[model samples]
Every structure is written in structure tokens, then in C-alpha cells.
Target: MSLIASSLTFMKTPLTAKLNTQLKLFKIKVKQNTMHTLNSILRMRRDIMKLLIIHPHLSIIGGSERLTQILVYELEKKRKNIEILVLTGSRNKELFPETSKIKFKLFKEAPVKAKNLRIKKLINAFLTLSEVMDDFCPDAVLTMIQEPIYLVLSKIVKPSIGTAI
Candidate 1:
């Protein structure tokens, strides 16, 4: 009985040691695998040189409006093809020359002078532009016109470039 007890105790010591070693190895392997996956994702994004920018609304106003315009310039400067699909465009469409490849689609266009009824405009605009977006399916959707539409679409869509989509 004493001999049996000694053997069982010895077996358990080695068994627990093996388990602990396996656990350490598994932890190291998991971290390496996670890092490898993250790097691959970043590399894939970098490989994509082409970009589609969808601005839900844009008009000659606000800091966001200015930022959106600047981002387009930066993307274009990087030689990434910029497809500016505006669901509701402003008078600034003329800002980019006709020669530019930037395609402009306007569900609603701004008048010379604008009033602040953007929320109402967005609700109405979404109806017409939804079809356009389905067809266009841009890489990112930038919301120059701050409403819930961009958020809704982006949730289902990936690479939704909030910077200037």
C-alpha cells in the first residue's frame, strides 16, 4: 500500500508538470498567432491602393466640411483614385475640376444660400441615395452631413472611412 501511494504521488507530480508546460506553450503560440493575424490584416489594407469615398452630405460649412475636402486632396495626392460620390452634394462640386475623375452623384444639391434644416434633408435624402449607395458600394463613407445614415450603413460595411468617406 505504501509503495502504491508513492507511485501515484510521483505520477501526479509529472502529470501536473507536463500540463503546466503545455499551458505555457499554448499561451506563447496563441500570442504569436494573434500577432501574425493582425499583421496580415494590416498588410491587406495596405495592398488596397484604390479607395471609394462616399460623403452622405457636404456643403460649404463647418470644420468637418473643410476636413473632408482636405482628406480628398491628401488621398488624391497619394495617387489613390478618388471617387467622390456625394449622396447630397453642395455647390462645392465645382471645386473639383470637370477633368478630375472624381464622380459626383447628388441626391440633393444645395442652393446659393442654405438654411439649417439638415436633419430633415438627410431623412428625405436617404430614400433616394440608398439605391445609389447599393450600386456604388464605396470602401468608406464619410459623413459631411452629420446624420445617422452613415453610421447605419457603416455598421454592416467594412473599411468605412469615417475620415472622409
Candidate 2:
């Protein structure tokens, strides 16, 4: 099994300090158990032009969650037609006012000020994403922060273009 899968097994074992420690060791900080489809996401690089990057909050500010911003920038730079649609996990906007452009959009129910209710954010992201997909039809929608929820949603809505970073 891969590191991710093993991590999942460890997580499912139980909820305890040991499990929490294991989750941290493996960086298993996701909102859902949708990671079973990660392998498909790895197969996405075979095609690149039709890409859609997903993020829960899509914040372009200072936070440990800057990986989302990095994903957007990297994809945008590599593919000129990249469209970043944020499935916002935060209640507030993660905006870089000086750098605002048409590249990003949010699907958040409420603005999150802190990381208290992570599961709620993931649920919000999932609910909003279904509607967002119908409007913004892309060949492939991708993400890294939202983990399995984003990956599975992308696959269901359209082709998923995932990458390992």
C-alpha cells in the first residue's frame, strides 16, 4: 500500500492520541474519506490544457494553507487557460486585493475566521462545488488542499487533473 492508504488505515483504527500522532506524521489532514480515488488524480497529467484547480478557501494570504495558492500559480503558469475555482472553506474571503483578477472564484456559505470547524468547511465546499461544476465546465478540475473531497468531486463532475506536490 502507498503512504496515503496506510495513513487511511491508521486513521480508521481509532480516535486517540496515537492516531492523531499518526495522522500528523503522515500529513493526513483531510476533511473526508474520499481519498480512495487519488490514484486517478495521479493519472491526470497525461493531459494538461483542460485544467481546473480547486481549493477550499482559495486564500492568497499568510497561512499554513498557502499550498492552494501555490497550486493555482503553478497551474496558471504552466497552462495559459487555467481557471482556479475556489470551493471556499473559510467564511471570509482569502483575497489579495492588489492582485485580484478573473482567475479565481469562491463557493463559500460562510466566512471562516479560524480552523475550528474543518469538517463543516469541507461539507460546505462539497455542497457548493456540485452547483459550481454545472456553470464552470472544465475538462479537468483539480485540488490538493481539500484532499479526497476535491478529487472525488472533480472526477464526478468532470475529468480530474490531480498532481502530487
Candidate 3:
């Protein structure tokens, strides 16, 4: 199990302490259960398990993007039945030449005025992602960032996973 730490403002409040404790406990639980989870997956009768990894952008080389790419490579190397599909909004495909081992889908670009409309662009991104999620029907969805699409995913029947980093 991998843990990504984010800077949290330290405080004396009980909420802060509780949050820290909960994180520690969650980490321990994951460490203990990881082996069992992998064994369960190995025993599953299904021929293939589709994993959709959502990374909003891949135009730049960032830590999260690198991590996602490494994860896809490692998972595919371990399990032949696991299919990794990287869903991104990045138009610059040349930057991710290392991801030839995994499948990728460039989501439809959301049309908006070429003016300063950040909110509208975000909304379009959410809609495009929603459509992709529906079409893919993946067994699991890993969202790298918390976007409005995450909220929409929570209401769907499929399982969605999110990370703090």
C-alpha cells in the first residue's frame, strides 16, 4: 500500500488529533489487509478486471502523473487479467510515450468560449468525464483529484476510489 502525505495545518483542536489518529489506523489496516486483498483477487473467477484511472491532465510531468503511470505498469506486470485504462483530458500525447503498455482514452474536449470562463470549463470537464465513466463501466475507478465528477460518481452504482494526494 502506498500512502501520500499532504501538508496539514497543525492545530491543538480535538478534530486534528482525531484526524491524525484515524489516518494512522487506516494505514495500519491497509498494511495488514493488502495481502489478503491480493489473494482474493487472484482467486476470483473472472477472466479480467478493468481498472479505470482518471487523471485530469497529463500534459506536464507531475508527481501524480508519474505515480499513476508507474502504478499502471506495475499492476499490468503483476496480473495479466487486469486491464488498465488511463482516462485523461490531455491533448499532448507525445509527453506520455512511456505508457504504451497500457490503454488510454482521451476524453472529448469540452467546448467553451476562448475567454476567461474557468467555472464553465470545469463543468464541461465534469460532463465529459461523466460520459466516459458511463461508457466504460469499469470495475473500479481511481480518481487522482477531487473534481465535480467525483460527486457525480458517488451517486452512480459503480465503485469510485479517491486519494488525498
Candidate 4:
């Protein structure tokens, strides 16, 4: 009985070692596949020009809004095949006619009384921008104003995305 137990233990040790080796090889293969997929995505994005333009708000037609409008027009004119997506907090659709790609991150007034609404709004904006960046994966980010929030969020979300103020 003791000899049988010893032999069983010896077999278990080799089986466990073999399982561990297989697990390690599987992990390595998964890592390589992930890297290859990432490289392919990067290469595909590089082939197309995707621009993400962030504006604070376009509720009213101001100088900044006009500049943004002109910039988008000129960019589209220059690069016919370029893809542009405009992100804003709030916008008047009448003023900003291009509604196809313009995304709004509107923050409704919280029902519960909050101490700092500004902070809450900032957090909401950051999260929204992060989602946009992840989905769009823009090659470059163009911000109309000198908003540090956009700059910081863009860098944090995707460091590869170039930001131009």
C-alpha cells in the first residue's frame, strides 16, 4: 500500500508540472495574439485620417464657435476624405448644422443637492471624453479653447492622440 501511494504521488507531480508548462505556453500565445491585433489596429488607423474636435459648448454662436465652424469647413475642404467628429457639451443644432457626427455631452442638473456642481460636471465630461476617445480612436485631437480638461483627458485616455490647441 505504501509503495502504491508513493508511485501515485510521483505521477501527480509530473502531471502537475506538465499542466503548468501548458498553461505558460497558452499565456504566451495569447499575449502574442493580443500584440498582433493591437499592431494591426494601429496600422489601420494610420491609413485613415480621423480628427476629434472638442468644444466647450456651441449653444450660442460666438467667435469661438465661428472659428470652429470655419476650421471644420477648411479642413474638410482641404482633405476631402478626412473623417471629423465634433464633441461639445451643449449645442444649438440650428447654429451647428452638421449633426451627423457632432456629439453632445449634456450634463443635466442633478436632482440631489451636490456641494460642487463644477467638479461633478468635470468628472462627467472626463468620462464622456474617455469613452469617445476609446470608441473613435482618433489620430489627432483638436481643441478649440485652451481647456486644460480636454488636454489632460486626451493624454490620459490615449497618449498616442496628438492634441492641438
Report lDDT (Cα) of residue 70, candidate 1.
75
Clashing pairs in 2: 56-88, 56-89, 90-112, 91-110, 91-111, 91-112, 92-111, 92-112
**Which scores greater on lDDT, model 2 or model 3?**
3
Every model: Cα RMSD to truth:
12.7, 21.9, 20.4, 9.5
Clashes within 3 Å, all models in order: 3, 8, 0, 0
In candidate 4, which residue pairs clash? none
lDDT of each prediction vs. the true structure?
0.57, 0.54, 0.66, 0.76
Which lDDT value does model 3 have at 134?
A: 73
- TM-score: the better of candidates 1 and 3: 3
Better of 1 and 4 by TM-score: 4
Candidate 4, residues 26-137: lDDT per residue as tens digits? 9899999999999999887676687888888888788899999888777776774567888887887776666333444443333544578777777776777778777777
After superposition, the stretches of candidate 2 with alpha carbons farther than 4 Å from their true spots are 1-50, 58-64, 91-102, 110-123, 158-165
Better of 1 and 4 by lDDT: 4
Report the poorest 10 consecutive residues by lDDT, candidate 4.
99-108
How accurate locally is residue 34 in candidate 2, as Cα lDDT from 0 to 100? 40
Which segments of candidate 4 are over 4 A away from where they belong?
1-45, 99-114
User: What is the Cα-based lDDT of residue 80 in candidate 2?
Assistant: 54
Ranking by lDDT: 4, 3, 1, 2
